[model samples]
Target: MNVRSQIKDYIAAQPEPKQKDLQELHGLILGIMPDCKLWFLDGKDESGRVVSNPNIGYGVQVIKYADGKNKDFYQIGMSANTTGISIYIMGIKDKKYLAEKFGKKIGQASVTGYCIKFRTLKNIDVGVLEDAMRYGIEQTRV
Candidate 1:
């Protein structure tokens, strides 16, 4: 199916409050980047074993590997995990920036190099999250 359809199916398959949160986040991200490209990754390998949670991605960023190959990828990604949800802001250079800048301000979320993880949306400050995402988008823009 198409990326939007896949994203809908993935979000619909999530359990309980997480489903609601995912929907809200989907809309929120869209509001942030209204014309961004959508992406969905089933998180599987060639063997089809479940490797990671399915991802709903937004925007585009080109990744350059050490082997000199380049690939297009999402600038921001979201997924439901066992304990919570993970929001990945993929193009930041400083590993400590998120944690140092938004960690304390983002409520209960864990701010890592390029990810903001939290148990639920209500437990975190959504505005700071938005700021981080905006920063990521700006940083990734070519």
Candidate 2:
């Protein structure tokens, strides 16, 4: 049905401890961006094929603006990979700016115009991360 329900169902199917970790992670993310509405992308590989493996992870989405203008003005999403968890700011351009500000404090950064990857949640400064999320949400500009 809804994206939140889809994510919850997906997580619910997992085994105990992994499911618990995912629930905690979900709570942490929701707490950080309380206004964001959830969406799912069902990510594809670099080849643009929908990944069939659950272990490859799924995409988390947030509709950044709701002026009833653009359909998907901005999307903030994340994916957990073998390397680390990634925070995607769909159309914002503050990755390098943010990384420069917190790279040393967090960890090494891999950046593009609007995508950032940190090896672990522990590596990021949650306050700064929250600010980044706000920036992403604002970038949609309704």
Candidate 3:
């Protein structure tokens, strides 16, 4: 199945995920972007090891950053755990931009020189996030 389908299936499989939370997040993405394609990364890095401590299924990917030939411009990933939901801005090269924009909440973001990690989706401004995502579609050139 495709990433978005996989995500839908995964979330549906969860017995007790707060329905409103799931719907709200899903709605946020759909509302902010109607055309993003999704992908699944299976929680393993290129080396084949789980990236999170407790293994949160897989990373949710959004392909809004794809190039003209349909190559991925960038991948945005997300996962939820006991702590909270994380918004992973996968593969960002511009730290200055992110830091300036998100520093107010994400604090000092740990950079992969690629991924920008947020502990909680609620911490940052949704509009700023949307703006960044839009920038990904426009200037990022991934």
Candidate 4:
């Protein structure tokens, strides 16, 4: 169906605790970007093979490739993984900023260059996550 419907279905299909957690995160992201464009990726390639986990996306930005090609993509993305949830802050040029900036303050989360992952929201500081997302949006805005 539509992007919102697809996102709702995807979140609803998750198992308990994850379903609830995803919903909460979806709400939080919407609050942070109330007017942003919504996106849903089923993680299928052009041939429809499952290459990655499904993703929920917000906002839009241009992704530049090393080959000089550029693509329009979402600024922020979230997904439920086997062990935890993943939040991706796309379009950042630096690969070490997230870890260096919020590594120690984000609690038990893994803060990589463009991703923050944790087992649960309770295991990390939501405020720090919020801050990171805010910075991501500001930095990646089209």
**TM-score list, all predictions:** 0.96, 0.61, 0.57, 0.96
lDDT of 1 by residue, 1-142 (tens): 8988999999999998999999999999999999999999999988999888889899999988999999999999999999989999998999999899999999999888999999999999999999999999999885
Write candidate 3's Cα lDDT for 42-137 as tens digits.
667779898853212222233443454444433454555554455555545675765566556544334333344554445546566656555544
Q: Each candidate's lDDT (Cα)? A: 0.93, 0.58, 0.51, 0.93
If candidate 4 were superposed on the true structure by all CA atoms, what would the RMSD be? 1.0
- Tell me which of candidates 2 and 3 scores higher on lDDT: 2
Deviating ranges (above 4 Å) for candidate 3: 13-19, 45-74, 105-123
Off by over 4 Å in 4: 66-68
lDDT tens per residue, model 2, 106-139: 4455755666676655555656665765566566
Regions more than 4 Å wrong, model 1: none
Candidate 2 residues lying further than 4 Å off, grouped into runs, are 11-22, 44-48, 51-74
Q: How should the candidates be ordered by lDDT, best one leading?
A: 1, 4, 2, 3
Q: Which 10 consecutive residues of model 2 have the lowest summed lDDT?
A: 53-62
Clashes of 2: 0
Better TM-score candidate (1, 3) = 1
- Using TM-score as the measure, what is the rank order of every candidate, best first? 1, 4, 2, 3
